[model samples]
Structures are given as C-alpha cells and as structure tokens.
Target: MNYFELDTPALLIDKEIMMDNLHSMQNYANQYNVQLRPHTKTHKMPKLARLQEELGSAGITVAKVGEAEVMANNGLKNIFIANEIVGKSKVERIRKLAETIDISFGIDNTYQVNQIEEVFEGAEKRAQVLVEIEVGEQRSGIIEENDFRTLLEAVKACKNVEFIGVFSHDGHSYKAQNIDECKELYLESVNRTLHFAKLAEEMGLKPKVVSIGSTPPFMLNFEIPNGVTEIRPGTYIFMDSSQANVIGTYDRCAATVLTTIISKPTKERVITDVGAKGITAQTRSIGHTATKGLGRIKEFDDVHIHGVFDEHAIIYNESFSNQVTIGDKVRIIPNHICPVCNLYEKAYLISEGEVVEEIAVDCRAKLQ
Candidate 1:
C-alpha cells in the first residue's frame, strides 16, 4: 500500500533513515568499545529492539518492569529496567522474570534494596541490580557517594541481590546551551558514574556495568570516554525534533506522524488531524525560538505546530498558509519521540514512499 493512503494521524517510519540510525549508533558503540543498549522505551516495539540486538547491542533498556516482561516474552533476554521497581507484587514479578531471563533494575535507596532482597531470597537466580547515580539530572538516582555505599552495603547483605554496577543519565544535556556545554556534562556524568564504580571496586565489590545515557551527549558528534562500559540511548533510534536541534540535523529523523490537514479556519490558521494525543504536547528547551514549539512540519521548515487540542494540531505560518490546503496529507516530526511513541499502537514502515510493513507497539501502555 502507498504511504499516502494510510489513515490520518498514523505513525510512520522511514525504512532507510531508521536503518541508518540503527547502524550509526551501533557503529559508534563499536568505535568507543562500550556496550550499546538502546532504550526500548522510545519505540517500544520488540521488532526494533531485535534489530538493535542484531546490530550488536549488548541488550535493551526499558523504563518499567512491565515493559521488560513484554520484551522478555518476545525473546529479548538481556534486559535492564533503567528505573526503580518497588511494591510486593512488582518485586515478585521481577523475581519470576529473573527465573527465565537475565534482567536487572536500578535502585538508589536501601528500602528498595530491602524489598528486592525479600523477593529474591532463596531464588534460583539472584536479582541483578544497578545503582543509579544522580549525575546532575536531579532525577531519581543516588546523589552522594556515601549514601550509594550505604545502599551498596544493603545489597551485599541481601543474598538474593547481586550488585551488577552503576548507571547515570545526562538528561541535563538536553538543556545544554551548546555542544561545549553538552560535552562538559557528558564527561562529568561519565566520570561521576565511574567514580562510583571505582568506589565499589575499592570496597571489594566488582562493578560489572558502568552505564551512561542521554541522546544529545552521545549524538553530538563527540566521543565516549574510556572505562564507560555501556551507553543506553533511546531517542537516537527515532531522532525527534529536540534531538535534531542538538545533533544539528533533521535528515536523520526517521519517525514522523502522518496527518492530514482537516481544517482551514483562516488563511493563517490551519489544523491537522493530530494533536497532543498523537504527537504529544511536549516541547524542547533548546534555547531556540523555532524549536520551542510542539513539532516540525515536513518539507515546510517555516511551518510549526503552535497549539494542540486533544485531536487537532494548530498551525500558523503565512508561507504554510499560502502553500498548503485543506485535505492535504502532511507529516510531523515530534519534539519528544519517547512519549509520542507510546501514543500510537502501531507504526507504518515506509520504504521509498511505499508502506512495506506494520509493526506493533508491543510494549505500549505497559505503565506498571
């Protein structure tokens, strides 16, 4: 089927560009001598994760235990939940998942470690776990090395818990003013994570994995530091508008939202069949006015989505008004591809303007 005939507001993946993204990141990892574990939370499709594995990704990283279950059931063995998993039911589920496949998750506190120990005690396989260090993301991770050691001691006390390693995310890199700042954060984040790894080794604990993640730092044409064992980047697979701003190109944006212009209320005002529910309301803070919008319009550099309703994306551009008309099909490159991916159930794979395949968002809505 022709891509133009697909239903409006559908997710689209350019086969050529997607393949290029997959291979580019994989090759980058090879050059840097670090394991590439592309986060599956961006695309949430088992098929894409498999492609990453085929391209030499050591494993796949997910955001939730439920998402891990989806990938594990689909034959993805080496999995890392890059987030903390708590609760009795959830811990038991993680134990059950460990019974079959190699899985690990992140923890920053000792309470969470206690829960993990209780669930995995006397189990056949200990629950492999990683310590999440807060390297300026100000998110969910251990900020102090002393506190990290306390948590490490707790993990050691638990016979069922195994101290796999430490990981950190340079999410603050997204707000970097320029490549120089991004590089600074990249090195700082990795060095901070490596510090913890060295601390573990000094304390007689073998830190098997030292992971650092963030698309901007890894894709800003910079080199990964030595001793950084793994890198988990998700948005590189589907280059979003925000990533484009950091990486200095949109030609690599493989995923787009295919929507049709459904309304022309005024000469300067038009609406597409996609909205916050489709392309997401998220925008990037890249210190640029053009990128401060919701998403980008393909082939129309001046056209930008200014507003969005539940099912409509509003656009206001004089050039776009003069060129586009109602009923015309358009494509949108979203600002944040991760959440935008979870908004759709399936994506149409297009090669040379033809719909070649349809892949399910197998891990969609796995919020638990």
Candidate 2:
C-alpha cells in the first residue's frame, strides 16, 4: 500500500531513515565503549524497541511501568523504568514484572525507597534501582550530596531493594545557546554523575551501572564520558524539529505527519488536516537553527505551520499557497516527536513512498 492511500494526518516513519538513526547511535555507543539503552518513550512501540536491540542496544528505557509491561509482554525482556515509581500499587506492579524480566527503576527520595522495600518484602528477587542525581535538569533527582547519602543508606537498610548505580538526564542542555555551552553542560552533568557514583563506592555501595541520558548533550558532545556505563537518549531514534535545532539538521528525522490539504481559504492561507492533536503545537525557541513556527514543511522549505486548531493546521506563506492546493497531501516534521507519537494509535512504516508495515503503538494510552 502507498502512504498516499493511508488516512489523513497519519503518522509516517521512513524505515530506512529510522534504521539509520538507530544504527548511528548504536555505533556511537560502541565507539565510546558505553552501553546504548535507547529510551522507548520516543516511539512507544515494541517493534522499534526490538529493532534497537537488534542494533546492539543493551536494553530499553521507558518512562512508565505500563510501557515496560507492554514491551515485556511482547518479549522485550530487558527494560528500565527511567522515572521514579512511587505508591504501593505501582511498586507491587514493578515487583511482579521483576519476577519475569530484568526490570529496574529510578529513585530520588527515601520515602519512595521505603514504599519499594515494603512492596517487595517477600519477592524472591530484590528490586534493582538507580539513584537519580540532579545534574542540572532541576527535575526529580537528588541535588544534595547529603540527600544522596541519605537515600543510599536507606537503600542499604531495605532488604527488598538493591542499589545498582546512578543516572542523570542533561535535559537543560537543550536550552544551550551554542555548541560550546552544550559541551560545557554535557561535561558538567557527566562529571556530577560520576562524582555520585564515586561517592556511592566510598559509602560502600558497589555502583554497578552509571547511566546518563538526554539526546541534546549526548549528540553535542559526540562522546560519552569514560566512566559512564550507559547512555539513554530517546529522541535520537525519532529526531524532531526541536532536536533538529540542537543538532543542526533534520536529515535524521524519520517521523513525519502525512497530512492532506483540506482547504485553501485565501491566496496566503492554506489548511491541512493535522493540528495540535496530530503534529502538536510544540516549537523550538533555542539555538540558531530553531524552527520558525510550529513545524517544518517537508516539501516546502520556507512554508511553516503558523497555527493549529484541534484538527486543522493553518499555513500562511505565498510560496506554500502558490504550490499547494486543496486535496494535495504534504508531510510535516513535527516540533516534538515524543508527544506527537502518543497522539497516534499506530504508525505507518514507509519505505520508498510505500507502506511497508503497520506497527501498533502497544504502549499508547498505557499511562497507569
């Protein structure tokens, strides 16, 4: 089947480009001697996760337990929940999953450790976890050395949980003003992560894995620190307009929303059957290469998505107006791929303009 025959606002992935992006990262990891554990949150499809594994990924990282369950049920055994899982119900779910597959999660606070310990008391295998150090994301991670020590000590006290290692996400690097700034942030984040790992060893906790994540910094530095064991960059698999700004190109972006032009309201106005609900309104505001509007038109370089209603993307450019007409189909590279993937139930894997496969987003809406 041809991609043109698919429904409007369909999610399309160029299989060749997708494979290239996957292998490029995998090869980079090998060159750096670090394990590549690409986060599945960007695609949220088991098929892509399997492809990553085939390309030498050590494992897959997910943002939620439901995603892990989806991958695990589909035979992807090695999984890591990159975010911290709290509450008895979630902890109980993790415990059950650990019994069947190699499962681990992130932790930043002591209370969460208590809940995990309480949940896996009678399980045959203890829960494996990584301490999330705040390496400039200013998000959910231990920022203070004292707090890190306290959390590590709590993990030792819990018989049901094991302190495996440390991890950090240099998300702030996305806001870097230039390549030099990006490199500085990358080194700082990695150094901080290594420092915590050293502290873990000094405190008598054998740090088995030291992981760092974030596509902007990972791609900018082009090298993972020597002591870092794993790299988890999700957006690298499906490059987006925002990521394109950071890395300086959209040549590696494999995902695009195939939309049909439904209206030509005026000489300077055109409308397509994709909007915030499809490509999303995410835009890039940082870096010299940031997108001008909501998303970039794959065929028309100067045309941009000026606005998006629930189901219609508004285009306002004389070149786009002159070139495109009603019923004509166009491909739009979204500003952000992660949330856009979540907007679709399935993605059409395309090769040479033909539909090669239909991949069900098994983890779609699995937010529990």
lDDT of 2 by residue, 245-310 (tens): 777778888999999999888898999999899987887677633678888898877678999999
lDDT of 1 by residue, 36-143 (tens): 999999999999999899989999999998999999999999999999888989989989998889999999999999988887878999889999999998899998
Candidate 2 residue runs with Cα over 4 Å from true position: none
CA lDDT, every model vs. true structure? 0.89, 0.89
TM-score of each: 0.98, 0.98
Model 1: residue 133 alpha-carbon error in angstroms = 0.4
